[model samples]
Target: MICPRCAASLTGKQRSGRICAHCGKRFALDPAVHGKGMHDIRIRGIAERATDHGRLKITLTQLWYLSRTRNYAWAEQDPQGVPAGIRWLVALPVAVALLLCAVLTDGVLAFVAGAAGCVVLVVASAMRHRPGRPPRSQIIPSEETFRQLMTGAWSTAYGRLPKGVVDDARPVPRPRGASRSRASAPLSRPTAVILCTDRVAALFLTANDIPGRLGAVLLEAAGTEGTAGRSDIVTGALKELAEYRSALPVVVLHDADPLGVLLAPLIRAAQPDRVVVDAGLPVSAARGKQGVVRLARHNRFADAEQLRTVAGLPEADAKWLADGFWSPIAAVPPRLLESIVVRAVERALAAPPPGPRHAHTNGFLTWPQAPQTPHARDTGRPGAGTSKREGTSSA
Candidate 1:
């Protein structure tokens, strides 16, 4: 057990007194709420325990299935820490016996006996409880699970759920005609465009004023055609991009998943001449992050197009895809992701002009220089021409 505030190891004295000796912070302990050793638990420790326990249970269930069915090949190759050699050693003798019985009994009786044996083995494996193992009813603390428990506990203690959680649950009432307000004026052409793989991320950026801050246009790569009236938002963004004076930098932001990795390539394919920079939640980022939630291999959310796109990826990325693990864009904290985007945009803004051959190779025209503001156009100095004359006027 450790102090949640300072990560100092908790002592027996502190545990008994309900105080963190290092941080001098007090934490409550309720036998009903925390169960045994309540004082020893940390908030993060609870979540880690829960997640580990869940994964362990799932692995055990899979192993039981493999063991009961006597699937030697799959069982031996199982990657979830199953005891492969033990499984193989147990299964081989049974398989050999089944074959020998068929030879001895001339097949018919052997089939009946094999079927009975299989059923008994499956049932027994499922029902058997090892004496030393913890019971299934034991609670495993997890961050998400603990958070939910704390929500209920807080409600009981304070007569209401936490204000943040309650507010998040309530629908935010948008002003009537808000959609019309968004569509009323044509958007100014931006210096760059950011394409997000999902609407949730795009909306998050918009809500945080990222687009205005970066002087970039934000667009969702998918679900535009399916969002009913919101399709106009996509159309308008595209229109602004098409009308931009320069070949504005087109940056692709996505999850560390297969689909996200392929977004830059997809955009490049659509407009072969444009310079598309992949601002990533790359596979490396996911691999490095301890807090990242790695989804199982063979995600249902992945489509055939995404699968095809990843086929030509580098060895490591391709292997990540084959392993069926992906980290979502949402896994990275919003602030961190925003900072990444800002840095990428700044780099693009500072880049020198692309070479003529590179820019014109695929029949795309060279990018025009950025358009000057109306004030700059008028006097060649922004806001200089519109100054009002005071008592002493300019000659």
Candidate 2:
């Protein structure tokens, strides 16, 4: 372990009771008790990278993913310690002695003992041949473990999280149409709406003020429990679309899961005239990569057939997601996720007004295509000379 305050390497002796011997300071986490990869220094480093060395702000949920050392699978073996050779060495003397006694004394009892010893040796060999546990790197620690480290251990030690790490940006939920935080301040008629399938991703963007920078309103995609209420933080989406900006471009960001892939189409159905850009994480990003951290769900919320037919996801990806595995967009480093959002927002901003071709359905990140015909302005598409709208949303 390394002392977070003094940057001094520590051994078990120096880290006794979770205190630094050289600096005489109390620290948050001990790798000895937690996993071998977890500690105060490591946490800080991961936070720094996620923030791009303090250029960006990150949420606790994002940090949780960055802290993982392994990507767990559904079926993993338990480690079987102690080799069969070692077990055989320990029992060989006893077994040979018993067999020798049986031959010398011609005793039935001694022969029975020798048979039992042979059976034990056979069982030990069989145990050795049994499948061994996977390596520790493949075993993912639960989110609860990281939560305790941040909430309990890190808080107790540092009095707060590391710099640039925002745990709960909005601790208390605000009623709809209320502006309580700086992140939720009203904008002047937002021309675009950024719908994040996961509330955590939306919260991250809000906490970091990413939407405000991009001149967009952040909304939690409907269908999840209690998420409808979150849309109230600003004005209702219907009012924003129908009254304020009827042709507002909607940018959808989501995890690489069944529900995520289906969310963009749902949003399009809700507002057919609006331009929709699918900025969600693709299944390919999380499915086959050994290094990607994919979390599993116990229940199957959506099916592969729907993903393939409706969302247009390929067969293999749909099958993987139907098995209830997902990788969160929030898991992408804060800087990268923010940058991608910026790019998607730019695409949204370039989108034209509603017309016959009002939406986009490209693969991973679909952008509204350029107006195909002349006099597109007559059909409601934006003209080349049209100026970009400066928009914002209320809290």
C-alpha local distance difference test of each model: 0.45, 0.65
**In model 2, how large is the Cα lDDT of residue 325?**
65
Best by lDDT: 2
lDDT for each residue of candidate 2 in 58-168, tens digit (9 for 90 to 100): 678778777765554342244455676777787687777767776666567877877877876677666643343321212234577887788888989889888777776
Clash pairs, candidate 2, are 176-232, 186-394, 187-392, 187-393, 233-395
* Candidate 1 lDDT score at position 30: 41
Model 1: residues with Cα > 4 Å off, grouped in runs:
1-186, 222-246, 288-291, 297-312, 351-395
Q: What is the TM-score of each candidate against the true structure?
A: 0.46, 0.67
Q: Considering every candidate listed, which one attains the maximal TM-score?
A: 2
What is the per-residue lDDT of model 1 for residues 1-395, given as tens digits with 9 covering 90 to 100?
56645668776676555566888765544433454333324322332332233221111111111111000000011223225455555655676676567567855798876765575455444442222211011112333444444455434444542221112223323323335335322246477778776555565455445666677877666633223433444444455446554467776677666656655555555465566666767675455433333443333344444555542455656555545555556434444556677877776666544465554221111221221211101112211222211110000
